[model samples]
Target chain A: MAKAKLDKEKLLWMYRMMLLIRRFEERTAQMYGMQKIGGFCHLYIGQEAVGVGTVAAMKKGDYLISAYRDHGHILAMGTDPKPVMAELFGKATGVSKGKGGSMHLFDNEKGYMGGHGIVGGQIPLATGMAFAIRYKKSNQVVVCSFGEGAVHQGAFHESLNLAKLWNLPVVYLIENNRYGMGTPLERASAVWDLSQKACSYDMARATVDGMDVLQVNEAMKEAIERARQENQPTLIEARTYRFRGHSMSDPVHSHYRTKEEVEEQKERDPISSFQAYLLDKKILTKKMADTIEDEIKKEVMDAVKFAEESPLPSLESRFSDVYA
Target chain B: MAEITFREALNQAMAEEMQRDENVYLMGEEVGYYNGAYKVSQGLMEKFGASRVIDTPIAELGFAGVGIGSAMVGLRPIIEMMTFNFSILALDQIINNAAKLRYMSGGQFKIPIVFRGPGGSAHMLAAQHSQCLDPWFCNVPGLIVMTPSTPYDGKGMLKTAIRDDNPVIFIESESMYGFKGEVPEEEYLIPIGVGDIKRGGSDITLVAWNKMVHVAMEAAAILEKEDIEAEVIDPRTLKPLDEQMIVTSVEKTNRCVVIEEGWPYAGVGAEIAARISALAFDSLDAPILRVSSEDLPMPYAHNLEKEVLPSVDKVVRAAKKVLYI
Candidate 1:
């Protein structure tokens, strides 16, 4: 609601949310190595600010859909970490009741539609949700997030065209993490600026520094307002980097950028930069930051314990939910 | 009661349902303004307006996923596939997303959508256009597959499918659109997963569906002069098959013959044969014989196409083989 300044508590809360996502993803990476979380697992270690800032700009009842690298997105949308961790552990208490693992986390009650697996699969679904919102004359906006690689998919182009043609209330967020499973954006995309791809559909588009939480939040605010007010659609390319490999199986150093490149990106870590901003502005003291770190560490540990103790889905659970 | 063509029945069903529920709308290529590719949605657009009867681009995958997404949030969308053959471009969305969305989300949302269009062999349309894709969709869970034969069944089943809170694959025959039948003027709905015994007899049992039902009836009529009484059964819904009705007919006839327009290897007929073997193995007099189209791409030549499709003679031959008459 406010254009510029926020109170001290809100800034600290945003910093703490980012820290939670960072630590949660770190634990998930460790769990993957230990074989506790099986199957394709993508970590959101460095892209927490994109989810945190975008979610901060969304209101209740606004829908969100994203690609496989989505743990941070749902967590930043105020979903409890307990079920998310339990889902990775394949427990019945998980958000999808152990049916959907890391790639398909869903919670309708929170308006988090899904974390779809196939590349660009959720684009049209999110566009259709915007259609539903418009048909019902509801002021809710739908935000769709996907990787730069998905820009090459037919669904991406078709959905964007329909969104603009119908003037649906939706925003397309492209988290440009430089590489899509070892292929750099330069090698994959003919156009260096991914946001301009929206130009073909006559839609509003922008590119922002994804590492800056405030900048991302500001961009999301404008996009969401435009969608809700004028029924316009926007495509925003958030320039960010993934600190980890594409997935757990990918080797960190071989056939891709060097270790130096990763370390260089770490210098611009979104969480570290945001924490420094708060301290510099006197909104947070050293002792207060230390206390928040301790609290988040305990929360992460509790999540792990909860996942370890949760029960696996029952045998009959397999037959249920096939139809409804 | 009124005598109406299958196309008019389909149009009336959609118009009635759209009038009943504001959430029910149709979206597909040429469904609006152009009425329909086959004129099955004629005059409904002028009544329901453009927002309700939407015309979409040739992007099947895109619009299909959009329909699934709208269904997730409580809007009932009927997505016409133009034709079942064109649905191949949208198979990823229909099978991967529409069929799995509910189960993958742990039953958090119900996809109340229908993907309907003409299917099966239609004249000399050749390989690409003439395809019966019921087997491909029937094999998937979280979907109800329905094939309606007559005007009454077409109107009633489409109405039920629109109201049902699940994804339905409604397959119709392009050749049978002009076939006329009596439909009640009063409101009515036909429940899915029910089979109809079109004509009852006692010597042998013949199972068929959709347009093939007419062929089965012709074959049965030809066999009647030879003193071989035949009972023709149409398992209208293929997925939730009326196994009890089929097994009962097999028990009484002591022989079975399956006919369909699709290939024989893995089709609805094959599924029916397997079910008869599993459920009524003890009641059989001979091995169940199948009458199916030759396993090759549909040829464009009229004579070759006629030879490729199963005819009344072929069904009679298969029936006599099981009957040993």
Candidate 2:
């Protein structure tokens, strides 16, 4: 395959999305500390490049589904941050009508299926969506994202086998952040290379530098193209890392990992590296990067305000939406 | 009207629905070239082609989730479970994803999927294969549980379930598939959450569903020989139960007997008995009685299986106890 040239406009947009996710997650952590956001809040701090770059490769009509650590994925899909933040605040005006909190954000109009709470529950759902695309005879594809921990689940294997058996048009992207809520990959999985699991289903597989947006985008574009053109599924493992603790309840450096290890990993921060790359490539200037950061900071703050002022769902709403 | 077996009625329901809407399709194990395990989907693959009548591998959880995923995006899928016993393997998909997706997404997705297959005791299939799981589904708020007693009811209720915008657990019986009943040639639908009076009388109200409705009918017949009349009511849709109908019948009869094929503890009969006590307590002339399967896993021996399940004798005994006869 020839090396596809990256468009300057898309590169700039990816930078903006990555920064926006970073700022949004930082504020979310603050809001969580203020007791504004409750429940299991998993921030996508270090995995911004994976979400931004992979979503950038998807077409307009294509569908995307992911696990609970999903604020970045939905934001990368171009969903308005206001409703997403309001949903985290459990407000009526929020997306999903505030019924789904941090772990269940949904933007149906954007083709962002949901922020599924279960570990690997979204795999079969994504395959099913791909089945629908084929059933409808459309050129659309589906991108399913899950954490590294989900690969050990039976749902993951079952869905992969079905997708390969039917030749469904889906890309099962694994965001391997090295931890399943504190349990390291070495402790949980016998096979270290998650991409090898795809070989069991006789499917295509790839592994990419998830911290680099350009590389992630390149790999995703090729896989998505294969899905749209040949109607074949691909399993791509994006090697990434989560900068924060698993959830709001856990400390940044838990007993499982030392503070020095977390600090060393932070040196290879995805946002700063991508920002430096943009500047060096002349696609984004220092002045432009500063301006984008300021804009995103304000935008994220506005979203926080919107969520703060939003009203709680009415008493009658509890009974509604349960049937239809 | 045409007389047809319960299996044929279900086949007709799937055929008519698939013909009516291009979005509706059937997918399950052995549903294609092999027909259905119970042959309920006989000739569907030949009629609709492989794309519509898909044959899935023996992966219940995977296929069940796939059906839900398809339904989420506007395709109506009828997922056959081979038997309700196998459906236990896909409970997470059915209960968590299918049932709760619409609610959890705040109504962003609608899972218009139907999971239908045989359930309950069939010959001596034993404990693993035979189970009356109506109460398990009935406990969930988002799911719609339906158990049709006759061919006519099965056909009509399944059509309604197909058109419904919610997940419907359409549990059929392995034993009742061969039973024949008169079904209308013209298209008709039995509205959900409505009960049917198989045999009406004044002495006592016999509440039953699925295969137990037949047991209640036989018990009603035995009660008639002793000059004790019983009204047999079948609440085909169990989740959104026809509570009003049962309460009204109990109000008139003032004596009620709840019959079910599941174990006694926390069973569907216990729920009905509780409702009767709450809704028509003052109307009762005697305490309501329940005739349920023995509180144990179904035994394999022919005599033990019969003894474990609800029979005409048990229903009659419960009816007599309720009526002070």
Candidate 3:
């Protein structure tokens, strides 16, 4: 099949975003090791394309909700890395005012609804946001992303069922990273094809290569369009892989799959592959790619500086924000 | 003021709120097409249409989460849990998401949602359907737990819960649905965290809420015949408890008894007793007593059900114990 051609500028922008998420996650992992970030850090290392491409397809007003591996999604939504890093550092200047830490990054102005920690918690919430958009007669769509593990949760199926029933303007985007905290899809789900879960709800569904940013973008575009135009929900299962363990606490190797398997998957790493594709298409020049890498690294370092310099939350701050 | 059933009062409150705000909507199982399982949302669908008043599959967790999500954004969602028994399935969304979202989101999102339904012992309904969950909801910090006993409180408090910028667990009683009380026809709202002195007395304080208010009132009447005046106080909201009202009444009476339909272990009565002891300890002439359901799952038999639940007789006995009778 012939590949769909994307605009050079759009492709380049997406490539930059992919690099940003990759670098951001790498830094986040290092920060977790340094104990700068605390409280359950789920890295989105290998799932960069899934977040970058899907976010590229979303409209300005559209909302994004994701599970704990949400740093990439929030960064892709264009939130400055400083506040997000500050949040991870538990500083008062964090996007969630330091209260939400790593697993609960929220930037309402950017329409990033949350970085929900619960596995399937954001599913129904995204569906409801879609319902709200329809209720208010708005064109906005909600893209709720979760791992393959979340597909087993009752909230996932329940939300999908209602999203279809209500014809909600939502996209239930499953970033199928294969393993659900050491348990593979074979062990976690009855059905290997996670997209087939949508068949239960009789909703529009598709499976895309999550390693290919272009493929993911195309699938997300169709899903988001169907949601915005037809007021319908779509279940897009992006077959991706998490390069890291389930969380920061998980060991780098041994058990659950060998180091060779990790190396084999790394050859198809979304960032490296997408960079090669961009270079092949001449959408990204050698100089542009190097500059992008340099810029992102500098930005990440500055974010770290911002986080380190940021003040910790005051004792009184803890009491505030509990209520409206 | 006009007389209305507790069901009708709830329906009116939802209707008025939906009419007042375009964002407010109702969603739950049988809420629309079936006119609600308990008929509390009877006319809401007809008045507001299917869009505003939605009927959902018996998926409690889904709809409860949908309500929370919509509330996170500008919408005010009133999710009906058919009965509080059914709400157990959605407690994750209610407690973890709805209650904690505002705090978790650092006040970026205010969950102006109400999870309201008939709770507590009702007729011969067995264990699964008749458990009272007021205390379970009250235990959560970010939740405003409302237990409306009368039609007036039901309507007024439901309105307040719908408008409040936090998740409100508005608990009603299935047994009290058909029970009629005077509800004002004019617009009104009973503030949350405020207790109402249903009846004035100088001898003893009878603190209760929801269906137990009826039990307390009945017991108060029984005590009246015994020449013992019992002040009846209904703490409409449980979490931001009306401590001042309870303590003042306890101080005035010098003795107190609490009544609730839930089990005695860590129940609403237990919490209130602790609060009263802390605030009104010096003024208390006797130890505060509690009248609660027997610590057992509700049985199917009518006689057994009656024995398991708090009753007027039980409330009277509790009051007598606290009164040193």
Candidate 4:
């Protein structure tokens, strides 16, 4: 699969998003190891291209929602890490004003509905979001991202049925990271082929190379285009993987796979693959790319400072904002 | 004032509101063509047309979520849940999305959708169908749960709920639908969270709502024979609880009896009993009395259903016990 005709800036922006996500998660993993970040932390280590590349294809007006491993999705959707970290820190300055911790980052202003906790909970929600856009007659499509694990939820089936039936403008992104929490997807799922699930709903289904940003962007451009024009939902399985344990609680045990398997997947790492592609095409110089990395590192550091400096919500503030 | 049934009053409210707001639309199972399961939305299809009034497939969660999303984008949707029993299917949309959207969105969006229908036990309706979700929804913080009993309340409170800028779970009773009461033809609104004192007296404060309000009324009427002169208070909206009206009634009567068709252990009656006792502990003439539905699955037999649900006799007995008769 090939990417669309893109100017230097668009490619650079995509590069920056993938770089930002990689750096952010790297810092998060480091902090999590240091016991700075607590609770369920699922990293998008190998699946950077799926979220970043797809989000880059969508407009700012379009909606994007995803699952618990959503730090990358939010960053890829363009939320400042200060608010994102403040949220991870449970500070008031976070996206949900600190009410939603790491697992529930929401920035509706930027069209990122949320990082839902429950598996497949956001499926119905995303469909409903698309329904709203349809009801209002808006051209915006909702990019609803979920893991291969979520296909089993009743909500997933119900939402797919409804979204397909109504022909709502939404793109159902299945980030097949090869494992659900801890269990490898092949062992858990009855239908090992992920994109086949979409066929049942009569939706346009495709499998993109998750390790390649160009392929992801091309698939997303088509999916997003179909959603906008035809107002039909598309199911895309981005065959990807995670290079670490499900969370910080588990050790990097190889009970499920061998070291050789892990090593093989790492070779097709999305960030590195996209970086190589960009360089080989001569779209960017090494110095310019280094400048981008330096800028992101500086921004991540600044975001940490901003999060630390932000004030915590007051005790009495708990009673407020339950309803409008 | 003209006498109207609870169902008629509700229909009038929808008709009037639809006439008033251009953005408002009615949608649900049997809401249009079949005229609603309970006929609360009877003949709405002809009156409002298919665009304004819709009969959706039996997809409660799907449609409810649609209503929430529609509400997000400035469409005021009034969704009819055939009964409170079916609402369990849409609990995800009601609880997670509708209730929490505004708060979760950091006060960025307002959900102005009404999930309205009959609640509480109806005769011959089996275990799966017969149950009151008042106490269940009242426990939820974000929802404004309204259980309107009389024709006046059915008309007035629904108007308020439709106009309200939050997700209002408007609960009614199947038993109260045919019960006729005076309703004003002119436009009016009964504010949510306000308690109505139906019959005031000095002996005891009998707090109830929805169909149980009628039971309390019958009990109050019977208590008059014993010269008990019971005061009847209806806590129309449960979440806001009407503490001031309840406290005032308890302060004056100094005795209370709460009747509900939900299980006694942790029902609306429990909340009323606890709240009144906590507020008017010194003013009590006797310990608070509660007459509630039997704790079991409501059977299909009419006799068994009647025995399980609260009735006039139980309410009267509870009143007498509270008044130390």
TM per candidate, chain B: 0.99, 0.99, 0.98, 0.97
In candidate 1, the residue pairs with backbone N, CA or C atoms under 3 Å apart (3 or more residues apart, or in different chains) clash, namely none
lDDT of 2 at B236: 94
Worst 10 residues of 1 chain A by lDDT: A1-10
Residue pairs whose backbone atoms clash in candidate 3: none
A1-324 per-residue lDDT for model 1 (tens digits): 113365677677789999999999999999988999999999988888888889988999999999999999888888899999999999998889999999999989998999999899999999999999988899899999999999999999999999998899999999999998999988999999999998999999989889988888889989999999999999999999999999988876567799999999999899998988888888889999999999999998899999999999999999999988
Please provide, for model 4 over B3-81, each residue's C-alpha lDDT reduced to its tens digit, 9 standing for 90 to 100. 9888999999999999999678898888888888888888878987877787677778778877886786678999988
Provide the DockQ value for model 3. 0.83
TM-score (2 decimals) of chain A in model 3 = 0.98
Q: Mind giving the per-residue lDDT tens digits that candidate 1 earns over B5-36? A: 99999999999999999999999999999999
Query: How well is each residue in A1-324 modelled by candidate 4, as lDDT tens digits?
Result: 355477878888888888888888888888777776678887777888899879878986998989888899988888998888877766778787777777777777788877777787778778877877776688999999999898987778878888898889999999998877668887788987788988898999999888888788888988999999999999999998888777667655467777788888899888777777788888877998899999999998888778778888777767777867
Task: State the lDDT at B291 in candidate 1.
Answer: 92
Q: What lDDT does candidate 4 reach at residue A2? A: 59
lDDT score of residue B209 within candidate 2 = 92
Q: Clashing residue pairs, candidate 2?
A: none
Candidate ranking under lDDT, highest first, comes to: 2, 1, 3, 4
Give the poorly placed runs of model 3, Cα more than 4 Å off: A1-4
lDDT of 4 at A232: 90
- Model 4 chain B: weakest 10-residue lDDT segment is B101-110
Best by DockQ: 2
Task: Provide the lDDT at B314 for model 1.
Answer: 99
lDDT of 1 at A100: 93
Give each model's whole-structure lDDT. 0.92, 0.92, 0.89, 0.84
Indicate which candidate wins on lDDT.
2
